[model samples]
Target: MTLRAYPVRYLPGEDELVWTGGLGVTVRFTPGVEPLTMADEVDLLVVTPEDFSESLQPLVEHKDSYGVATRLVTLEDVYGGVFFEVRGRDEAERVKYFIKDAVEEWGVRYVMLVGGRNGGLLEEKWWCPVRYAHLDDGSNWEASYLSDLYFADIYNPDGSFSSWDTNGNDLFAEYSLMSKDILDLYPDVYVGRLACRNSYEVEVMVDKIITYETTAHGSEWFHRMVAVGGDSAPRAGDPWYEGEEENKAALSYMDDFEEVTLWTSDGSLSGPQDVIDAVSRGCGFLFFDGHGNPMNWATHPPHDEETWIDGLGVGDMRKLSNDGMYPVCVVGGCHNGQFNVSLLNLLKIYEGYQHWYSYIYKGEVSPESWAWWITRMAGGGAIASLGYTGLDWFATGDGDQDGIPDCTQYLSGFMHVNFFWEYGENGRRMLGELHGETVADYINAFFPTTEKLDYKTAEEWALLGDPSLMVGGYP
Candidate 1:
């Protein structure tokens, strides 16, 4: 099939509005490129990287106005370059994966592929449909691993490279080994780890780890790795030892509230009974700190006894079980705030009333930060009443002895700004009163504002905030 490329140029010296009108009609005509002129075919519009910005503007406007799903294809390898340009490589990869999936679903072929510095030597090759075909088949193309690899040598604004090998390698090796073992047991299963730079690395690691007659081994392994059993495991212990002081302080703050209920155990409460009871008693924020699986709820061992015989696991959060005054559920766990299909489904089951924030990483969170987050909510700084706290490092508020621990405060402040600026402008202003200027300013002032912020500085800045803050409270 011959692909017709549509190029929209913002001609200089020409009337911008007129140019936009002409561009819109030109884009509208692009749907005729495919042989099968179906609704789905019309959905796919291919454009070069140069035109991506302009082309997407119209599509975004159209979608907002009419609620239509129009997929756009950019030849630019947004994911591959992301590791070089951004910090969260895993997120970058996820975005890329999502784009690929959307393109495939729209029945589109070929994207104008560009190469990044670490995109490997193969990326230097000219854009070819065969290369695109290989990626589609998952045969000859390189598989994604995680964001750590791409950001292994992040660049500084002054052209210096930030070495993240020491930290990243260790994490990657462990995750890789674990993935390999899991794939070895179940060869057909898809195994992937989320990476930095908005990407996810997925590759077939092993041949098999499970076999007949070894059912016990398989079961044990599955339970250990995948099950969300109660908080008995070593990993379930509070990872933030630095947060002892802040945690104490937060507990002190909680004393002012009526009833502070901390759901530290794993697994879903039996048939919403606990939730019902809490609601009946008019409980405050429902705080859940425990292990969680995307599809199964595994309570701590002893509590499992109370579970229903046919009760739903994590997968059943979308189904009806109990109805009453619902308290906002704050899931201090991973991937709970994905804002994707799973969360949408969860919304459906809860009659779209339950507030949920999920997908919290353990390392980037702290008791103190959690306390501050809830305190802000209780203080009426926010009205959404539910949402996941973004990634944060667990640390004591007194580690640096300024007020909040530098890392915890910075991340908390950043996420607060990001969330409020995007979703709650008023909330952002209120948070600003507590934390001062926005996270973007904080990041740019101290950290290297280059294509790639050196991972070392990134990590350091993540901990210490702007270095100027170290000298004085005012930057």
Candidate 2:
């Protein structure tokens, strides 16, 4: 069998060059070219709908006063050709192009997207367009999942525009037999989203950010960390406490903080009330490792995958009253970050039982994902959260033949724990920086491919909070 060479062109006239066993080789280096148009440097760029701009102003001011150098631009500014030249196949692409320009022209290091479904729960309109990745893993009900990483990965290693749709089929992030786009999977700029469905939510989140950053410093609650888990996959055998092990890994990295463990092994995590009670007390960080869906996160009792333990659900968010002391939550599960879900899906489901099953694969079938609800909760809930937008995967055994269980290495379990590791060991103070660095580090450690779960692992994992967030608040 002969191997086919895949050539990538980063600049013009690259295809014209042909090297045929040259007698002598010469290398030339050129100085970097300056930008043709320079704009005011912006450290954090907040992209929101016009309706949200007013609500987000306080957040911008707070960031500026804290020396983050933030600037707010609406979706209108991007699409109307007011600031950035409108150019892309769709609105989502156009938004991505604007982010690319912001990185180069305005020197933007972080991007915060603050918008969600524009209308009521039954409406399908979006305040900020979302990009869906068409990476089918056959086992999952949905072939596509929401991916914000597309906006942050601006360019490939070759310096070419990293349009996720490299095949030009307009199907972004395809990783199936039908189509596959080789992605760089490296974040050029740190990106996060608030996914606020309305202006009220925007105001609530802005207030939360301001209060957290300004007053959270030196608070004893900020030094506490809550870690909860149960048996994630008992079928895998042996330890029978995969969830607890993952949580322990995160706690290991967070040695400075007081650790609070609620595990099935100890019967502390018997029900959702346990989670609600623990979170109400307030802590700097919350790590939940288990199985999850759009509305709830659940797990099995130790060594028993059949019996389910409803850990936490969207409905339980309201029970939290940890106001002024919010934890940055990291959830290890599936569909917890599926921000595309809307109330309109219920209408489709009401049509009939047949349509209900069919619509599940098409996506958008929930009022809100667990991560979004937690972040948008008025007085309590997590200040920020990271979770998967679709079905998550973990190695059953030593899939990589690396001696250690692959589940503990580079899929859902590893990504969830690494966020804390990056914060504690690597000293990634900014949430987005920690998130972006974690993605880059994961890709570096496990070379992702179209057929491998690694690609989807990196693509589907998303952050729901300000990318410029200061973990444990600003000092």
Candidate 3:
């Protein structure tokens, strides 16, 4: 796949957040000495780097209208720039302790990390540390993934030690080594992340949040969902695409909602203007599955019989007709959550470590991953999006042509279905709890097993927006 350049969307006054700051500070607090009081009675705490801490106040204030007692704190404010020198502990332990204290002491129910998780490589202490998981991959190699679940997994049943690195191996999120009693599959404290790389990006996001929340939107508009499923594999020889049948099956959970099925638009994924037009009409939820990346999703729109994939992308955000109404988009695609950019990742792409699953790979122009761009779109971005930071694991059969190769046996479909079921059917509202509940549901369904695929699946997927933003069910 070749890189494609598309027109970038711009929001006026977005340049105000550009700031210059480098890693040249000294560590302040010593180990076992985070002298912070957890006496503040707040429901939501927004965490950011100290540089952007001032600007975040406005965003926090705007979110305050939502009736949640929201507060803003810098990582330094929480950690005092201290690096915990414990096994399976690092700078991220600061956030862990803060959250633990908030949950234990204060009435804090939600904690939102409001900056990028990509820490600077060379530093005595990490900058905006992200929690990590050490799950063994199916390939037999140990795979470490960025996980927010760590902060939420604060204490064990005994409430003695923070069960980060069990077996004292100094590795956090090693599910195999960690004691089960410590693990909170259904985390009591809800968690979220902003995932912005810079203050400018955060500013843009803040503007969107203010505009979205301040304006009154129709509840029925949100109840109207749109499901788009693209070909999982090249339907070069056949007319109909793969993944639609099962995707439609998964979409059935939202049967009551006024929805548009793009996979079977006029009965197939090849409908000419179905999805492009569907977005123009407002909806509460958007579900898409198929070959894709952060830049673009694959679709055999209208013509193009030889599986010439032309699909939606970040560049198309400007052209979208949806203005104020933002849906919660769930993309069952690969690498839409690969928010960080690096030259080394290009090399990984060549080595198949970073698989480019779509036709239109991201070029130099687009600001963030298409997955995130959906939420931050100037016209109308969703409240939240869930996608894979890496490959969305799916089970494939051994050249079986007897029937439709049902990939729904994979966790991707189950999670996708469970998400809708949690929202549409179960009447659950908040994104993070829904995410946790879905993971817990999947685990409960497939318990008494050591399947690496299921474990790795939960580790790689993430939510890309506000977790506490409740999508109050069908009005």
**C-alpha lDDT (0 to 100) for residue 166 of candidate 2:** 88
Task: Output the better candidate (2/3) by TM-score.
Answer: 2
Candidate 1 total steric clashes: 47
Residue-wise lDDT of candidate 2 within 1-475, one digit each (tens)? Answer: 2222323211111212222343553556454574334466899999988988988888888899999999899999999988878988899989999988888789899999988877554456788888889988888477888899999998886666789998999889998886788889889899999998888888999999988888888999989999988878886545537788888778889878998898988999999899888888889999888888788888888778789998888878888889988999998887888887776675665677886666564334657788989998888998999999888886444443445554566578778778888999988999999999889877765563323577888998999999998887777
Q: What TM-score fits each model?
A: 0.28, 0.89, 0.74
Candidates 1 and 3, the one with greater lDDT: 3
Model 2 residue 168 lDDT score: 90
- Model 1 per-residue lDDT tens digits across residues 388-418: 2222222122333444433223332233323
Q: Provide the global lDDT of candidate 1 against the true structure.
A: 0.25
* Model 3 per-residue lDDT tens digits across residues 58-131: 87786676676887777776766343222324567757777776665676788888776343323212236776
Give residue 171's lDDT in candidate 3 (0 to 100).
67
Best-performing candidate as measured by lDDT: 2
Consecutive 10-residue window with the lowest summed lDDT within model 2: 8-17
What is the lDDT for 407 in model 1?
Answer: 26
